[model samples]
Target: MKTRKLTAADAEAYWELRLLALQDHPDAFSTSYEDAIKQEDPIGRVKGNLESPDAETYGIFKEGKIAGNATLRYETPVKLRHRADLVGVYLAPEIRGKGYGKMLITKMFQAARGRDGIEKINLAVADTNPAARHVYEQAGFKPFGVEEKALKMGDTYISEIHMTLVLEDDK
Candidate 1:
């Protein structure tokens, strides 16, 4: 597997990969497949965020196919600029056992460190996703809190775990 900075031209591939994540591994993400597929020009929307100043995407390709992706989205305004939100993380299960998820977040950490003002990386994962939580912990994130029963699906409740990795932790 290989990692690279994302470009606008990669949007179509990104969109499909996103839908795959939302569809195949709904538990690891906050967005529902129904809400995602309803958007018009999904590819364009992905491209827009990927190009923003406070936003960027990185993809991991396996055998010339997109296998995983992670996005870094910052608070869009100056007042909220001290923080950045890490979102849209997904890795295809067919290639899941390998280290792609760890690799993706490592690359994101490096990318974030290069920026002048980003102080922390924050993300929320479902409480049930131990595998992902392990990956994040290995990548230097520490649990801060949880939003109890934050998500509901068909009478099932899923708590959201909030975690953060301080930039200095990389030292």
Candidate 2:
């Protein structure tokens, strides 16, 4: 597998994988597949986001196709500039349980540490997803809190466990 930061040229491939992620695992993301498809100029929006300076989206490619992706988004406010959020984390079902999730998260950590002021990276994982929670824990993320009933789908409610990884300057 190959891992790298995505660019504007990767918009289409990224969007395709993103939609698949939302469709396959509706509970994992905040955005619904129906809502995502309804968005206007989604490709253009993905392209713009890929080109943004405040965020870095990393992709893991297997057999020349995107197998997984995770994004590190830096806070824009001056006081919060030292913090970053790890979001939109998803790996293809076929590739799960094979260690790719941890690898992808490692890349996010590298990207976060490469930035000037980022001292910590935060992320939220659905409490229903033990696999994802285990991966985050193995990557050194500690739980800070939990958001009760963070998402509702149909008649079901899913809570999220908030996690954070503090970066050491020497690392």
State which candidate has the highest TM-score.
Answer: 2
The C-alpha lDDT values of all candidates are 0.86, 0.94
State model 2's lDDT. 0.94
The TM-scores, one per candidate, come to 0.94, 0.97
Quote model 2's TM-score: 0.97
Alpha carbon deviation, residue 98, candidate 1 (Å): 1.6
Q: Write the per-residue lDDT of candidate 1 for residues 54-131, one digit (tens) a residue.
A: 787999999988889898887867776767788888888887868889899988988887777889989998998889
In angstroms, the error of model 1 at 118 is 1.0
> Quick one: how many clashes does candidate 2 have?
0
* Clashes found in each candidate (C-alpha, N, C closer than 3 A): 0, 0
What is the Cα-based lDDT of residue 65 in candidate 1? 83
